[model samples]
Target: MDPLYTTTDDPNDSMENISSNFTDSYNNQFVQPVWQVVVWAIAYCSIVIVSVVGNIVVIWIILAHKRMRTVTNYFLVNLAFAEASMAAFNTVINFVYSVHNEWYFGLGYCRFHNFFPIAAVFASIYSMTAIALDRYMAIIHPLQQRLSSAETKLVIGVIWVLALLLAFPQYFYSTTAELPGRIVCYIDWPEYKIWDFKLTYQICVTVLIYILPLVIMGVAYLVVGLSLWASEIPGDCTDRYREQLTAKRKVVKMMIVVVCTFALCWLPYHVYFLLHMFHPDLLEERFIQQVYLAIMWLAMSSTMYNPMIYCLLNDRFRAGFKQAFYWCPFVPEGSYKSLELKTTRYLQTQISMYRVSRMDTTVSTVLPFGTPDDTTEPAREEEPGCLRHTAVDLSPNGSTRDTHSKTTPPPSPTTTWTSED
Candidate 1:
């Protein structure tokens, strides 16, 4: 019999064949018909290309554009980085292993091969959780201050550290064992209670990576959605208020799509691993290899869809993506200007004055309020002891008073939101 076409009827021979001729036997048996390999190769390559380009564009938008640098966007940047890394490092390696049925990259990459995907996934899911919490804070308590850039940086730093710690177990346990002429990458648990250890580890990973984050994000988005939908806009109906409301709703929608897509894409992969852990016999099934490949590709495909979702659902992100890939003819010229997020202006004005008591005794005055450039109308007298302040106008050159104040004036505040980019 030809070595390539040899068949083992005995279970012992089959086991020996798997150990010794894993690459040759499995390739000859499974990847029959060259067209199947070509199709799968094309599909996996597309996933990698789309994932890398889309995630890199997101990172570029957040980093290059000053206005896009918000706390939520910062968390998104972290997520994009994780996805890009996973696609670049894990996807092709997985495809090769699936087709070849052996580890050929030697031992060093085998450790990383086991380690990186888990860590990247941990970081990605936690980043979503952080974004959910950020949105909850922003919407639920509008008066409360949002996380500053520095604070967000610190949080992202902690997330990566935690991800590394969580994935360290894989690196510790994984090894490439020589099986006849080939090497197979697998976890080498100790002789005692290896099943128990694997079960516990997998359970812990599933909970932290999937269940906990899912719960937090679900509750957060639900509350945020209800709050935004139920709450009423204050004051008269102005274009600015309309824009703000529209932007807020769009952001909520984008985030909901992101979280839901992530959950759906990863659900099958996690469930399969959990089932495999409990039933080792399933691994011997003829179709088990196909099932594993399908679930894994589904999981990795998750990274590619978020960028598409963002581009489709969000005007700001879409515009940013277009700007990054301006050469793409689909992007219309001069549209990004209007799509840029509205800049928020901040100014501080200090006042020093004396107030009169009932007996006309002087008292220190401490009145503070923020007014935008457009709302600096004459103050309507409401009651006694009421003081009205003038709104400062921000301009191209410098901040100038509107000259509409009737009372004693305070020190002029310099505006930082310049007209030019």
Candidate 2:
């Protein structure tokens, strides 16, 4: 959410005396030097550029490729869309308003400026929360049914609906006021004789958007981490099992880093606002403008880091990024194409073959002699009615030699694959 500034409703308050009451100030008295303004402009502009471009690429990577359209990636696409929309629509406007201490745009944008960031932030954090829950279900309870594609879309829609509901108050109360010398946009919260509504709303927003979701994700990841990392693998575990475990661990680790980055970036912003709510005198300080700008820049910078996290920590996302940027002179077209084209098929075939070989070994090991008993148990534990046999050419000459082999179904019914795999 954008930082809230104190504004007054009085038309008689002159520009010079505006800073008398920090809660009733319209025209800002503190002004930075030319060089400082230039530096800040560059800093803020960099965020907008990197955030918009990076998140759009992430969205495209997930949406354009059929192979990348998994449940996790769907939530990621929602996350990327929220970040990109916030960066494109709010980042520059936020910078300009905070730096200039005036509203150049009229009333409609003022409402949007105040409204959209809250919804976007709500969407961003909830999307991450959805991912945490999804991962927990996938890793901690492997045999459970996962969300289908349609259900995933429904969840995303529900997230946005809640986001809009949470942010509607900001949109409703936002208005532009003509001060002594300039115009300023701020929320004209209605007064209540019983309680301070603005402060109450601020506290609620911080709890809902920042504290609560982080706590839930923190606990979910904690259990998932223990399940994934603290367990001892069996001595007879196959390489296939090890690969799946490692893939799950990598995904959990990547998400942990993303969550940590977000928490750190917004921690200062939240603290600053809380302090201001309790003590309005802080806004009257001469250096408060610079402090606000710095804190806000850090908070807004969170929108740009997720794409980099995905590219660095996940192999499939890395390959998707390579394919997206294959036109660059430094990126080799051949290798990029191979990474995109061959990796999926190669992994699938290797897994299939390994499953077949493992089943063959199990059957041979269980029944050495040609005698079959009804009491004899299967070598491995599998879901009921899940085993299926098919004919494969196991001959070295690639001739039509009928060798029966067992293969699991497509997309793996038990475990969900992350974008990394």
Best-performing candidate as measured by TM-score? 2
Itemize residue pairs with steric clashes in candidate 2. none
Alpha carbon lDDT at 380, candidate 1: 17
Candidate 2 per-residue lDDT, tens place, 182-226, comes to: 777777677778998888888999999999999999999999898
Score each candidate by Cα lDDT: 0.67, 0.71
Stretches of candidate 2 exceeding 4 Å from the true structure: 1-5, 8-28, 332-334, 337-421
RMSD (CA, angstroms), candidate 2: 9.6
Give Cα distance to truth, residue 255, candidate 2, Å. 0.6
Residue 133: error of model 2 in Å? 0.3
Ten-residue stretch with the least lDDT total in model 1: 1-10
RMSD of each: 9.3, 9.6
Please, what are the lDDT tens digits per residue for candidate 1 over residues 73-137?
Answer: 78889999999999999898888777666678877887798888888999999999998887777
Residue 212 in candidate 1, Cα distance off native in Å: 0.5
Whole-model lDDT, model 1: 0.67
